[model samples]
Target: MTEISDWRKRIERYRFQGSECVKCGARYYPSRIKCIKCGSEEMRDVELPRRGRVVSYTVIYNPPKKFSKYAPYAVALIELVDGTRVLGQLTDVDFDKIRVGMEVEATFRKLYEYGEDGHIVYGTKFRPVVS
Candidate 1:
């Protein structure tokens, strides 16, 4: 990503900032300017819940060029404690042990490097919650 775009998204990348509609109490990740539920411009920034459960998942054997180095990684549809469903890559656990309803939590990690300067992009990924 370009430096300008990365700067603009730093908060979202690092903090898991989302939006909540003041009118209807709807919430979204990747914050929206307008509420899709109530069409209200009144919104507030909110931090998403870090803990969640795996709803479903898949192992990607062939990924895009940017992510090919991490091929065969597991990506999961996670339902957060607040009932927000998010898709994120699962890490730091045995692939065979992954299953529906497995507890997980968000962990910040490197996404990839881009641009001629090799700017490292960081973001959230999910790992099994330690007992």
Candidate 2:
């Protein structure tokens, strides 16, 4: 991503900032300009709940070029505490131990680096919540 676009997305990437529809209370990640459910332009920024459970997941053994370094990593469809589901890479856990309904929490980590300058991109990843 270009520097300008990356800078614009820092909030959502860093803090999981989402948009909530004022009319219907629906929430969306990556923030939306228009509410899909209510079609309302009226929306407000809300920080999504960090805690969630794994709904489903798959292990990527052969990823794209950008993510090839992290191949064989688990990517999960997680349902956050507030019912906002997000897809993120699972970290600091064993692949065999992953299961549906496993609790996880958001964590900021380095995603990747790109460009001639090797700009490091950081974003949220999920880790198994320790008991």
Candidate 1 residue-wise lDDT at 103? 99
The worst-scoring run of ten residues by lDDT in candidate 1 lies at: 111-120
Model 2: per-residue Cα lDDT over 7-120, one tens digit each:
889889899788999999899988899999989999999999999999999999988887887788999999999899889999999999999999999999987777788788
The superposed Cα distance between candidate 1 and the true structure at residue 124, in angstroms, equals 0.7
Q: What TM-score, to 2 decimals, does candidate 1 have?
A: 0.92
lDDT of each candidate versus the true structure? 0.89, 0.91
Badly placed stretches (over 4 Å) of model 2 are none
Total backbone collisions, model 1: 0
- The top-ranked prediction according to lDDT is 2
Worst lDDT run of 10 residues, candidate 2, spans 111-120
TM-score for every candidate vs. truth?
Answer: 0.92, 0.95
Cα RMSD to native, each candidate?
1.3, 1.0
Measured with C-alpha atoms, the lDDT of residue 26 in candidate 1 is: 87
